[model samples]
Target: MSYENKILQMKKLLKKNNTQHVIEKEPILKPDVPNYAGIWQDAGLKMIENDFGVVFLLEKHYPLDYKHGAIYLRELYDAFGKWQQTQNAHPISLTDANNLIFYDTETTGLKGVGTHIFLNGLLEESEDGFTLKQYVLADPSNEVAFLFESKFWQGRKTIITYNGKSFDWPQLQTRWTLNKKDLPPLKEHDHLDLFHGSKRIWKNDIARMKLTQVEEEKLGFTRLDDVPGYLAPIIYLDAVKSGQPDALLKVLQHNEWDLLSLLTLYVQATNLLCEGIAEESATTYTNIGKWYADLREIDRSEELLQQVTNQYTREEAVNAYYHLGFQQKKQQNYIEARKSFQQALPYLQGRQQIIALIELAKIFEHRDKNYEFALEMTKQALKLVTESSLWTKESKTLRLADIQKRKNRLERKK
Candidate 1:
């Protein structure tokens, strides 16, 4: 069926028989997404009626995240996969998908030096109006730990942050550690860091990889009047000192739009990724090779891999060759495996170097019975490894021991 039809079907399944559900459904048919304020109006009303606290709508003149550009869907999926084993919900059918926390913090200093955590602004939803909780540093010992230390972050598993992976995660980890508190095992949580992720995808056209640019260009998000982040410290300080909450409100709104922009980004990225791999000639050939290899369909894998051999990059060519080598090895085709490994050896370096070396060693030792050469390769592997790797030390130790035993047997025969 058509893509829109699939979306409609998924929407139908997810559509709840409630006012909020109907409201959410109405927007899907719109010609274009309404402005940021329009979204706040609808979501805010529901929040207010349910006694959710007032949604702080802050606007920032500068982009929230200046690093990282647009990200590809597949790249995001891979990153998310590293953190989470599975998604809570499928891409199109997002019903019952737990809400995400789109968070950003404006700190006293960017260097992360010293013990100066000046302010943390968080925009979250409640049954009442939407709430923007600003943790202020009234004194040197101001602890914003309670905001994150609570069970609020426990239930939900997905965290969508602009540059959380690099800046926010480390800072928060340090803060939690300082408090002698346990963080909520966020490594297992699906973290979508838009900064690096976006950079990977949109590094070509988007000159500035800032959140503000993506908001304006991609999501059509704009704020008429907003305070810049450079002035956030001043604004927040004044609001705290004189009991003037208006200046602080603008910062809150800036954070609030950040939260919404993150959501829109998720929606957009998911839509793009869910469209499946791009069908360009080169991309199609590479993906077909990937798909078949993943499924262990060696014949089909080899066919596609060969087709894409000269067309794609060296990395893709290496990957395809490795899989072909693996399939041939499994079939006891040692000569073919060696040929494939030779093709792949040019691309092997660093971590991949050790892996390819070990594989070649195994072929010599187990299949070819070239114990002397195998022992040399294993020694090379041992020399290259400095830390824990995908292959365990115990496994390497056993392999080395076995190779030693083989060498002894060969020596006895000699």
Candidate 2:
């Protein structure tokens, strides 16, 4: 018989074989199975409700619409912006064991507000790549491997996840909350979310940095004959209802690939930061400097900052100058740091102009004891703040407070 005829035969047998309580198998209609059809909803509802609550219905496939995918991409972009602002404070690197955990998840849907996650996969480095322990809910009752109640995660340190900050972590936490189950103490486990990391390093380089694309490009791994991601939940439900536990192989493979891809992405991102091209190297140094600063390793932070300053282009040079100045100021080396800020003064404008003026004020007020010069610098900063409509309320308030406080201090000195 033809493939379509065999599939029809299998469907007929499946329809009759699957009852409310018993899982029956019809004889194999063909040596090889047919491609997956749109019977996932039928399988899922039956498994979930223990009754055939829904029937199979196939809608026209619209794989390229991507309206929801676009939203996800934009969300990732905004997340990258946030990471860029703070990456210097918490840089994503493979070396920081006290600051990393590999996290992955298997979910029924994408929306966190209402979607459900059927499995939570947490991985750690093993001999080869990563040892994954997938916490799955096999039936409605039995804990697949007793994962949810396992004490293995009790005091573990960090969670390194892709988009976990926004999605996976929150989803898992919400699931635990709903179950009223004790969640392993996670607050202490600092998160290094890799989605932002990947975007930061690859946004301009790759057309799409989706996990599949990254796996193909970076790791040279590709899926062959794999089930589509959207169909995973359907397959899982089908396997459950029919007790054809073997049907879960595809979904299991998908989940495993997701877990491994997260690791591969992490490694690739770290490698890029460590060994990138010239301009990219400068960006990496700047980002690494910020991460060290966040970790309170001022020496490492200063060294990385110096790397950026040494090889920086005009734009990078300006940012490097500002950061080096701030780092020196933090270390109480006002004289040298003042020179760094002054170096950028020619190109610095707007907010940067305001910041430079404030630093100069600090030099005169505290170091030089030149209160008159300090007062002049503060006045210039205040003027700039007034001129800029984009100045934040907090910025205006802080500037006014600093200027007035200096004025009072100067009065006392005089």
- Highest lDDT among the candidates is held by which one? 2
**Which regions of candidate 2 are displaced past 4 Å?**
1-101, 110-115, 119-160, 165-257, 268-281, 365-376, 391-398, 401-414
- Model 1 residue 330 CA deviation (Å) reads 19
- lDDT (Cα, tens digit) per residue for candidate 2, span 307-381: 777777756566667778898998899997988887877778888888898888889888989888888878787
Task: Output the lDDT of residue 56, model 2.
Answer: 19
> What Cα-based lDDT does every candidate model obtain?
0.55, 0.60
Quote the positional error of residue 57 for candidate 1 in Å: 13
Most TM-score-accurate candidate? 2
Score residue 202 of candidate 1 by CA lDDT: 49
**Per-candidate TM vs. native?**
0.43, 0.54
User: Tens digit of lDDT per residue, candidate 1, span 305-360?
Assistant: 66656566766567667766777788889988877776887786666667676788
